[model samples]
Target: MSGVFIVSDNILSPIGLTTSKNFGQLKKSVSGIQKHHDTALSDQPFYAALFDQSGFIKDSDHKYTRFEQLLMASISDALQNSSVDAGDKKTVLIISSTKGNISLLETESYNPTIQKRISLPASAKLVAEYFGFINQPVVVSNACISGIMAILTGMRLIQSGQYENAVIAGADVISKFVLSGFQSFQAISPGPCKPFDVNRDGISLGEGAATIILSANPKNAQGIKVMGGAVSNDANHISAPSRTGAELCQAITKTLDNAHLLATDIDFISAHGTATIYNDEMEATAITLANLQTVPVNSLKGYYGHTLGAAGLIESIVSIHSLKENLVIPTLGFNETGTTNPLNICTDLLSGNFTNCLKTASGFGGCNAAVVFSKQ
Candidate 1:
């Protein structure tokens, strides 16, 4: 299969509006999470990373909700950095999000006429129209792994000659619906999340949008290339992951095989460390099962919290930057080993030559995905 290169990318998050700004915050170990006492979101104090509403763009001619504005801003910034034309027939758009415009259902005025906008397909169509994309936009909503799966889909589409280039973006805003659902599971951390830490309790939810432009042509591209990707399911439970991590191990092995590389070739890992007990433990088991216990691993959740559908894409972009800068970002809230298997968890920023990286994410419904990226 032909390799897909990431030509340009953007991230709109609580810490920053552009990819460089977000990455700069990450380099400085700045945490975007904060405590909130809003009764609209939750009755109790909760920690979350949220975009400032005051900084949002306001336009009367094309009024867009906060969620839609985030997607537009991210994609706009990404397209500005890329040579691909959004209006060209050869280009495609792919959106990844577990929930798009779901917050529209919580309007204070409650306009029933706008209910249809909450549908994922409808939201995607609106964004596509705004961007002038010729092809119908594709939507991927496979839980937290949605972002990586979208990228994988784009790679396959380009490799199969379905499209010459793909613009992929994902965003999910934190709303009362999502917050209450996770709260029912007792999965919300009281404070900032501590991934892979002995004192880790639960996840700190976050909201963000991310975009990446992928193309088969890599002429002047100095960015990382998508070498391989694989997705697998445990089918063990609806909400819980497999106890043995066998399914995730298969995903990692298949991803490496598709990339024509081995576990040792991976310089580091960008893990889906949600700070939840089962999630961190399961990832550790999978890494050990894949004989990657010695490989350095870090999670961005400590800095950005859990960005749901946007997590994989946002972390992938940061990992690409990590490769470009030859630096390994430390796991922000880690203090000690918490899982059964020993993992080379990065506790501080380390500088070294990095060539290849493995990114992994596991979500609800027992779904897991692994993608390999290499510096070209």
Candidate 2:
């Protein structure tokens, strides 16, 4: 916890595929949702913030899958943005994703499962080798919490004195499989997602990548400090998020414990308001359960849709940058409250003297994680 720190974080987002672009859209409150015409996949008609149509990559040669392409580009910029020496063979790479190039399963005419060739952990190797990282650890968290789990792993390495620096990347592309699967559960919404909204409907599928440079020593320049983090599981249902929010409460409490801070010390709560009826309610319940208040809580899903694994770093990057700018965009498309525990979702961008911001995300497999960051 002493030496472990942040070098820099970069996000390749659905808004612009770059931090500047992402920030540009944020200032304007632009929603990334777009209509889908993948008629072959479904006739129900769903809107998602898919990156495949972003037109940021070449379609020729090496035949890289969408997930791989996003991951590669994100890692490249993250290294440059953080000024990390990728040539350092001693550095380690930690990669995380729920579905790693899963689209390749159908393209290659193979069944999609854990035994497939496009293994999530294997993709980490592909990312590490790109920059000559010889020592690396791959975590294939199929659960929704994989992205945060991945970052916590890298933080653990720095805290345990196992690595001086760790480059962490998370990516997952929207595909027919992921889309149709969410559609099957009736979790696909037709418009912009409204996290914690009374009229909230379901989840929105988005794709992108987020990379962060983690250093064992505190940064002397610009960067947010990764004070501490914790992960948990509801154990209530496989897909039905628990209303008790026991796991979510524990995750934040433990993170605060590690940071030696109290609930009042936290300036903002980046709740995992996925806009779904269950996810929003659970997060609100968790915040109240933790006995936390006097903190502004909001979800960025409305701005960027749900970018899956990339959301952790993407949202964290925004949270860190906001510490200086003191701006958190209003939650777009929200018209009413839908849950018992009301969320103080900023409907208009607000500036405050905030120093510590917390980001929390919960995914499938009953998993959840929370991290606290401070101004450096």
Candidate 3:
């Protein structure tokens, strides 16, 4: 099997519209999460990282939904920066999102026509057609792990000789339904989230999109590769994560084993630090279980809030750039250790020669996923 390398990428978020711009902001410790009082989203004030629709709009004809608009903008920007031809017969498109076009359900009444429009496959095909993709578009919507799962899906397809190139895009937007659902669970933080911090309470929701283009050919002689990945499920409660980190540890160990690397080989970890009580504790337990407790870890939730589906890919992109730039970004809102197992959380920017990094994500239904990225 051939190695899958990232050729080009773009990030469309409140912080920036390009990957470089987002990385720059992270280096300066800037955050996109802010307090907003929008009655349309919630009756009370809430904090989130959201794009102003009027200012972020690229489509003049309004032919697509907000979700589709994000995917097209991100994909177009990424394609412009890469030589990969998305219209080629050997190219495939993969879309990842927990909720696609779900906002329409709030505005429009439920009907067959509206239902078809909101389907993930339907929205994926429309975006694929707009971008001239010939092959069927693959959709990954496994809760919050959708982003990493989608990336792994693309890597497998390329390694299996099914496609020469893959454009994987992941996105999600905040809506009334989404806000209320989190509110019902009392999961929305009153202010910016504090991942792995003693003061942390809940997650601050966010909206954004990111696109990562992968190809069998390296972008350069020393390009980054999608080395290996693994997924696991605890079969625990649907909404709550595992009481113990044993299952997530299985996924991490398996990923390291698949990559032919030991726990000490990893340079750092880009954790799925949602700032919620159980999630942070479970992730810490898992990392310690894998004998990676000493590895420096950071969470972007403080900067981007919890972007849900986009969280995994967005954080992974930052980590990739960190390797290329030789700088480790700090965890924005972390001040003290709060989990049962202590973690070496990066609190300040550190310069070093990084080679490999681990990206992990856990979502609802007790599902957990892990993927290893290496610089060759």
Candidate 4:
């Protein structure tokens, strides 16, 4: 069986539109996070990375919401150079998001009609129909791990011999609903978030979309393989992660084992450093438990902010490009090591020949996931 490979990908963020553009911005240590005083989003000023509403892409048909628009744009760009037929029976589409059309709730209450529009499955159907996909679309809304899980779902579907190609698109838009919820928890940082730093306070929210095309045929792949991945749940708390990082560690161990890799074989790590106190500490402990303490690690949250469902895919795309270019992107806002277990955080852009990289994510439901990408 041909391994599941990333044929093409795209990232639509405040920093850039395509994956290459985003990677270029990261190479220069550019950050999209900034302070905003939009009353529509918050009563008080907050820092976040958001798209320019004035210049956002629009469609003549008002039926498609902003969330669906983002998914369509990303999927269109990802399929530009690939021969994957969206309308073909052997192709599948998977959508990952934490909140799909949740913004509609701000204006209207939950009614039968409104609920149908706000439903993730309904939004996914709209996107799939827009792309002319023949199969029923799959939706992954597993909090922050949604993106990685969507990718893993595509891999498994292809491995099951049910599809030859899988187009995975993940997106989330920042809105008043999302902002107020995070604010309620005091998880919104006043300034730019400093991941893995002692003075780090909270996460800087962001909005973006990303798409990764997976193909069973390796002939035209980008010299990278979706090696293997695994997910775990600690079930310790609804919003907080496990204190000991044991569950996250289990996820990393299983992912490495699935990929037939050892901790020593991993060249770098793309950590799910949300800049939150507990998240960083827990992730650091998990990394140490997996014996990846010395591996060069970094997080893109400082650049793109915590993009919720899109975080995993956006960070994974950056890591993929990093592996191809042999350059490690510096952790944008990290200054000093603050985690209890300590991590070899990349503070400067370094060039080295490395083959495999690990990307990890932990989310609201005590969920943790780890995926490995290798240069084929």
TM-scores, one per candidate: 0.97, 0.93, 0.98, 0.98
lDDT pick, better of 1 and 3: 1
What does the lDDT come to for candidate 4? 0.93
Q: What is the lDDT of residue 205 in candidate 3?
A: 92
- Candidate 4 Cα outliers beyond 4 Å, as residue runs: 54-58
lDDT of 1 by residue, 91-158 (tens): 99999999888877776445655766777888788889888999999999999999999999999999
Task: Count clashing pairs, candidate 4.
Answer: 0
Question: TM-score of the candidate numbered 1?
Answer: 0.97
Instruction: Find the number of clashing residue pairs for candidate 1.
Output: 0
* Model 2 C-alpha lDDT per residue in residues 1-376, reported as the tens digit of each score: 4646677776887677677677768878877777777775566677777654543446467645677778888888778777567656546787777777777766666655535558776667666666677775566464666667777888887778777788888888877788888888988777778788888998777877888888865442365678889988888888888779889999999999987789989888887788999988888888888877447877888777787777787787778777757777677767787888886777778888888988899888788899888876
- List candidate 1 segments past 4 Å from native: 108-112
Task: Report the C-alpha lDDT of model 3 over 225-254, residue by residue, as the tens digit.
Answer: 888999999998899989889999999999
lDDT of each: 0.91, 0.77, 0.91, 0.93
RMSD of each: 1.4, 2.3, 1.2, 1.1
lDDT of 2 at 142: 46
Compared to the true structure, candidate 4 yields what TM-score?
Answer: 0.98
Which one is best on lDDT? Answer: 4
